[model samples]
Target: MSRFTELKREVYEANMELHTRNLVIYTWGNVSQIDRDASVIAIKPSGVPYEDLKPEHIVIVDMENTIVEGDMRPSSDTKTHTHLYRHFESIGGVTHTHSSYATAWAQAQMGIPCFGTTHADFAYGEVPCTAVMSDEQIQRDYEEETGVQITDAFAVINPEEVPMVIVAGHAPFTWGSNAAKSVYHAVVLEEMAKMAYLTKTLDPSRAPLKQAIIDKHYMRKHGKNAYYGQ
Candidate 1:
């Protein structure tokens, strides 16, 4: 068996979780896990239905986007995932999804505000939305450019601190220490997007959660002196 066998299985299971959790439908999403030491990533094969997917079906690609293994083509968003793994050195996995409420926020080109503690528990502040891609960027290597657009949009925020972002007119991308966690972040982003949307509908004049409260919730879970989970 290839040494990458286990990693391939992990990536395969992560992709399946997206389907089981209803985070994706009809192959509208992809998940990838990177083996930084090998400089390769195992990702969902392009357009394959989740039910038909298997560990050996996971495509492995290198940093330069060369296929290293597997019989199938990597996800259509391969370049975006490649660019991210190249730049976000600390992240080990990435997931892209058009989950409804989050995609709705991306379509609206609005950042999801930290309107409650549930959001702050994971994200420190607003979940950023990338600026719309320029015509040239959209026309040239669209997938790779989309990745650049996301990295550029995050210039002011720490990717480690905020694990997710919505691309303007596109969808959400999330990353974490590993493939499983990336899917976890995607689920959290979707629920928070739904919550924030309903919140605004109920009280249009509502402001983002107060910074002190944001600090309290965020810190309790993530600060130097954190103590939220056991």
Candidate 2:
């Protein structure tokens, strides 16, 4: 039930695209994929720059962040992705990035209130940011605590449907049923965040899309009537 080496190559390429496109800088982001048959994920190793990244650098980890294969350690955010795969039955991939304005919203500890069609199209409404971290959490190592925070962050939102959240004082995390779409959501979230930022600056009280429009847009690309692709 092992994944093909080529699949790992594809994941590595996508990870490189994030840096190449400026969606990430330094050593700040990661992408991972779950292999359903084996209950394992292939993740980019920690702190490797995009140029130096090699497909063989992808490490396979189980649901609990225990490395199963490969020579390097998984991304520092491995536990966060581990928590997601354990909780959301349908989530096959998870991605995290500190893409500018999205991190701005996360740092501000506020949700990205739905602004315009672009935001609505991807998120159905506003992209939610978790409330500020508790004092105990803030006192600890932020990244490990971020894993705990994000797991708790979705308490009020439906993770299966929403598929993304911004951790307070941290950044954005997005997921989908596969690696490619997970990256797609990361890119889309950044665009939506930028759009929402400009909207708030120009008009402070902008509201979420009406429920009717939200429902129509969400359903047309998902659920029983989805028409997005063949």
Candidate 3:
């Protein structure tokens, strides 16, 4: 049996969840999970439809983006995934999607405001949107540069505190302790994005939820004294 059998299975399921949850359509997204000890990641193969995806189709690539196993090509976003794994030491998985509402915010170059407890519960503040990619950066390796944009936006934000980000003029990328959790964050991000849009549409003059409420909601679930789930 392949040493990466379980890893591939988990990543495959996570990628399917993106489709099943309506976070992705056609071949618009990818998900990946790292095996830190092995210095490898199992990720969705490039351009493969989720409906036809199977466990063995999951590609395993190293930190340097070398294919270690699999018959299919890794996601075109493979470099971005590897770059993230290299820079974000604490994160074990990453997911990227072009889900409608989140992509709308990304294309508008606006961050999703923490309008209520739901947003605050997942993200400490407005879900950040990376600065638009410069012409020079785009001229570089575009996929790798995408990772640079994400890390730059995260310079002041803790990945642990804000597990997701939307790339300006692009889409959303979310990370977590594992592949499944990253997909969960992606779903949460999409819902929050939808809610924020409707709220703004309904009240253009409305303000963000106050900092006190944001803190209360976030801390109750994630702070040092957290007691949210049993």
User: Which candidate ranks first by lDDT, i.e. highest?
Assistant: 3
TM-score of each model, paired residue for residue: 0.98, 0.89, 0.99
lDDT for 228 in candidate 1 is 81
lDDT of 1 by residue, 1-230 (tens): 88899999999999999999999988999999999999999999999998898899999999988899988899999999999998899999999999999999999999999999999999989999998999999889999999998999889898988999999999999999999999999999999999999999999999999999999999999999999889
Worst window of 10 by summed lDDT in candidate 3: 79-88
Answer with 1 or 2, whichever has the higher TM-score: 1
Model 2 Cα RMSD, 1 decimal: 2.3
| Per-residue alpha-carbon lDDT of candidate 3 for residues 60-85, written as tens digits (9 for 90 to 100) | 99999999999999999999989888
Pairs of colliding residues, candidate 3: none
lDDT of each: 0.95, 0.80, 0.95
Candidate 2: list runs displaced more than 4 Å.
1-4, 138-144, 227-230
Give model 2's TM-score versus the native structure.
0.89
Q: How accurate is candidate 1 locally (lDDT)?
A: 0.95
- After the best TM-score superposition of candidate 3, give how far the Cα of residue 171 lies from its true spot, in angstroms: 0.5
- Cα lDDT of model 2 by residue, 1-230, tens digit: 34558668767877877887688987889998888788888889999987789888888888878999888988988877887787777888888999998899888888887656566567766677776777887687565567677767677677766777888778999988877778888898888888888888888877766888777777777668689778
